[model samples]
Target: MKSACATKYEQIEEPDMANIVDAVLEHEADDRPAIVGETRTTSYRDLVDLARRLTGGLRQRFRNDEDVCLVVSHPGLEESLALTLAGWSLGHRVAVLPPYLKSRELEYALEQCSPVVTVSDQTPDSAGSVAFRTLLDAPASDLGSSASEAWLETFTSGTTGHSKCVDRRVSRLSDDIEQLASAMGLSADDKVTAMTTALSTTSVLPALLAGSTVVTIPLQTARQFWKAISDTSITVISGTPYAYEFAGRKKPEPGQLKNVRMALTTSARLRPDTARRFMEDTGVSIRNIMCSSESGHIAYNSSTDEELLAASVGKTLPGVTVEVRDDAGKVLPVGQSGRICIKSPYTATGYRNDPDSSAAVFQGDWVVSTDVGYLDAQGFLYLTGRDDHKIHFGAAKLDPQELEDILLSHPAVDDVLVVGEAHVRLGQIPVAQVVTSRETEAAELLAYCREQISATKVPQRIEFVDKITKDFKGQPVRPKYVRFD
Candidate 1:
């Protein structure tokens, strides 16, 4: 049986695929810097030429259009963009591995994707991986072909479980680039700090496709990130909540971040307190954008309304529909929280080579998310928590996020995670693991919680920890088991 979802991939046109590189070449501001790094800057003309040369290199090595090219490199660089462009230009499937993955994780990704060619700065222990320096000298040649069927595969953050390989059509991605450019109000004169990698479709591709200059900075401490933004005169910035929280630790001097017009955050839930502190420190509101590896830029809160920014993920973007559904897959009414599902042209068709997993999420034109959220009367979405992260209590199921958010509001708390622990009386009880900034007693926190939340929602135990585990994307790692001291 042919799935209706499968038909979405059959509508690609060659001209649509060609738009990737053409967007770079036909940009009106060709002389302006397209890629600026710590030491060197590449003009638009130079970047297009680099991608052309690399595309020729890719074509010489892999003959089959089915060949997948895996890219593993440090974030915030022109090389990553050039390599990705090269792969797309040759009509080959491309997958980008996170830079921070250990050798074992890299090996797992390699075993999963089995790319015939890999372009990286440092060689992975696996075979078929080539250093990026070797590709730079490859002879330049003009080539024209569209990998319309060859989609780009990106893995989920893997915070809750194993990462799923998501396949997005190149044609739809091109459409998203233009739509995003118009929605974000990006222009050629705008300079964005590419804090995320080329793998991040929302952050890197839209800015480049809009002909905006992107400044790439190496992953650095919070202080270094601020310095880079100030030095580069970065007009826009985007990253995870942790990145913004770390930057909020030290307030920028007056006018230090004057050049930065907009700050965007995604990949994890942005705490309201973090958002408020960031604005107070930098004098800029952090725009909380809702997106996933499968669905690109579903919603964004562009208004300066602090209350709205703190509570909702903002209104849905044009051409996208976000709705909440009950357990029966029936759409719920506004204000009724349930599974958050999205219907959009930009949503990925399915996971590559994983039918069981793909069928679990993709339904017709909708991607039914594992996340639990509700929509307001005004069409704003508010996320509650993940369905998988629920705790089974005596007669009730509790959302750990509800408790964690309350704990995080405390002045002494730096970070917190709530998980279910076995209880003889109740089926399970919630336990809180905390990373604190100052001296704080578990009793004190418990007492504070008693004053704020319901008795059933309060944590039975609170353990102080030095750090909380998180994935490469800065999302909290759900603990598999409760630790006993």
Candidate 2:
């Protein structure tokens, strides 16, 4: 899908922090709806008050430029937003930790970030951190701060071992807010609910910073999301591909999302079929955005149809430049696929404490990393696969996304994953792990692939599975075909 209109180029401007908070505050008076929960409706004014109190509390415990780790807190949007804004306003860095992290993972993140303050409802018993708080019932402080400091330290989403921090300059955040506000046509009257966790760079600040009243559903269950959208009168919805797939497969009640004018999916590859089903089920079609924490949102599929939106993640957002490159770092032709690099105002300065890794991924002004794709003649970006997972089979290389797209088109297949694995003979082959309708067989699926794609591009083998799993951020993880003989 093409962008709505080419954004006019303009010099980057830094937003006034006090003005941003005040704009959101002013919007609350005329635009916000009463957020309904188990107890009752919470006015926007009430939410602002809570944020002020919570920010005060967080400020008191963690001084300016200190690091804080936040765990998933339930059923409280005001408290969470307050803590996040407070942390940012006070020039403290915040790290969002997933709730399902095992003790080992938690320990690793804590040790890596070395946060002076840990703001979570789930404080581990053995934690000997500098300062810890439950974040509720804490007293507010009057600490002074400057806007030039770091606001948050977002860990890399794809990393599995010790987390890597991307400490972003707080001043760059407004660039994203402006992009979202323009791309999505956001207004203060829009009540936004996102399936994304607060820890993500895109989800938390952009909605609130765009002057929209933000509502959140605890991500434990999809049903909670349904409830929050209806109860909060959410007009805008944000989620990852997996979350949108769940909504499609589960066929959630339609009444809950009647008021939603737009639904957005980003972070991972979105299947075209899933987009089709989502639009058919809900009146709202999916808005797929291609983005990274390093460079906020680079592009968005603004078309309301499922196929175009799904075909490509879409054209570049305002103030961003995208290019495809080969191993030699030379630019590739429009149709040729290679490493996808982005240049944006919001791009990270460098990865924190990992200059070697940083230098490997970034050039003079662009973030050059694992993403692999190409832009079309029409300026649409099609993400084929991750550079790290590129599959070399005999004479030709295959992008997993290319194969997965073909597999997902099959009626019998519900979800599919393509991954590269070592093969003694071939060196590496594309293995497909598929979740399918009960009647579908591996042989039949393979036959279907033969008709759809070239034999070299077809999967070496297909495995029927009961479920396709996703990571916390809702991207497809391991393809279900784990070979253990």
Candidate 3:
């Protein structure tokens, strides 16, 4: 019996399979802003010329088959984008390293991909690396087609452990660009505010392919973020829940974000309160998007309803099918919570050089996500938590996200993480590390949790911290908590 997930990639004939650079070069006469940075803007013509020069530089430094890793030290820069497009144009596999990874994490990434050439903002301590600026000095080189199987290698967030390198082909990316652009209603006149890092290529690439000018902003602070949106006349924006949480802190003036038609959130879950508050202040709806590194864009909340946004991750996108399955892989009925498995044309082939992990997750055409979720009767998907994150407390299983979400709803709480702590009596008990506002007391927080959730779900120990450490994906880094003797 054939799996319902199995679907062939719809073949679309085009002059170029590598869409980004090809589109820019072909539309050089169009002379519109392709990339807008903090200090300057790159017109489509300029972008094409820059890519040509960079391709020449890359060709001089490395062979066509060699892999190149882009470590984006400086976020929202045109250099990173140029180098990436150039590598694709030259038929070399390009790996984009996450911008927020620490030194140790970066070392791990280098070991995993082991690219022949690394383009970075800072001088890499490792051999066979060059500064990004040097690429601009190279003379223009002859343009070439992408390699037949050339891939864009992206690493997982490594929050759980070491990141895995997921290799997605250029053809797959090209197909996704069209699908996403059509779904998002992107057009040539739109100005997209790219709040995500360079690693989030889908966020920026789809907009670029739609002929929209991408306005890059440093999402370091709320003030800077709002100012950028206001100044750039941004029509669309994509970011994580953490960015919106920061935005919720400041009240925007009337019509400040009026130009923004859609505000998309991904990477981390967005709390209902955070969405409602943001909508109240900015008059823009916060749409939660559920996606993965392996599978491109899976589901999105298309509706502007705040209540729906808070409850569900929205309906699956066109050409994407989602199913909930039990432990034995039998499909579960709607509203029955189980593992969330996705079947999509845009799913990546497999992980690069990690067959064991690939075989574990990717079964035939379906990418069996580690996330646990359920589907409503209306086809709306509600993510419960990660399957691995479930805590076995006595005989009762508890999801930490549920407790964390309840705690996050409190007015004084800034951020919170709930993890299992070893207990002699119960085997493991829930413990919460919270970052709160100045006035929020530990006792008050505990009382609030007691009021919200069941006794078993409540944290056995509550410790207040200055801030919660997060990985590149804005997910809480699980800490090695002190064991109670």
Count backbone overlaps in model 3.
Answer: 0
Note the residue pairs that clash in candidate 3: none
lDDT of each: 0.72, 0.62, 0.71
How does residue 108 of candidate 3 score in lDDT? Answer: 61
* Sort order, lDDT high to low: 1, 3, 2
On the 0 to 100 scale, the lDDT of residue 412 in model 3 is 85
Which segments of candidate 1 are over 4 A away from where they belong? 1-4, 8-18, 72-76, 122-127, 130-137, 143-146, 158-161, 196-198, 218-221, 389-485
Off by over 4 Å in 3: 1-18, 67-76, 98-102, 124-127, 158-161, 389-485
Off by over 4 Å in 2: 1-42, 62-77, 122-146, 158-160, 196-201, 218-232, 250-257, 304-306, 389-485
Candidate 2 residue-wise lDDT, 357-432, digit = tens: 6666556667786777789888888877665555645424466776787789888888988887765334468889
**What is the lDDT, from 0 to 100, of the residue 88 in candidate 1?**
74
Model 3, CA-based lDDT: 0.71
For model 3, residues 401-441, the per-residue Cα lDDT tens digits are 76787789999888999888765435468888988876766
Q: Quote the lDDT for 354 in model 3.
A: 73
For residue 165, what is the lDDT in candidate 3?
74
Q: Which numbered prediction scores highest in TM-score against the true structure?
A: 1
The TM-score of candidate 3 is 0.74
lDDT of 2 at 277: 77
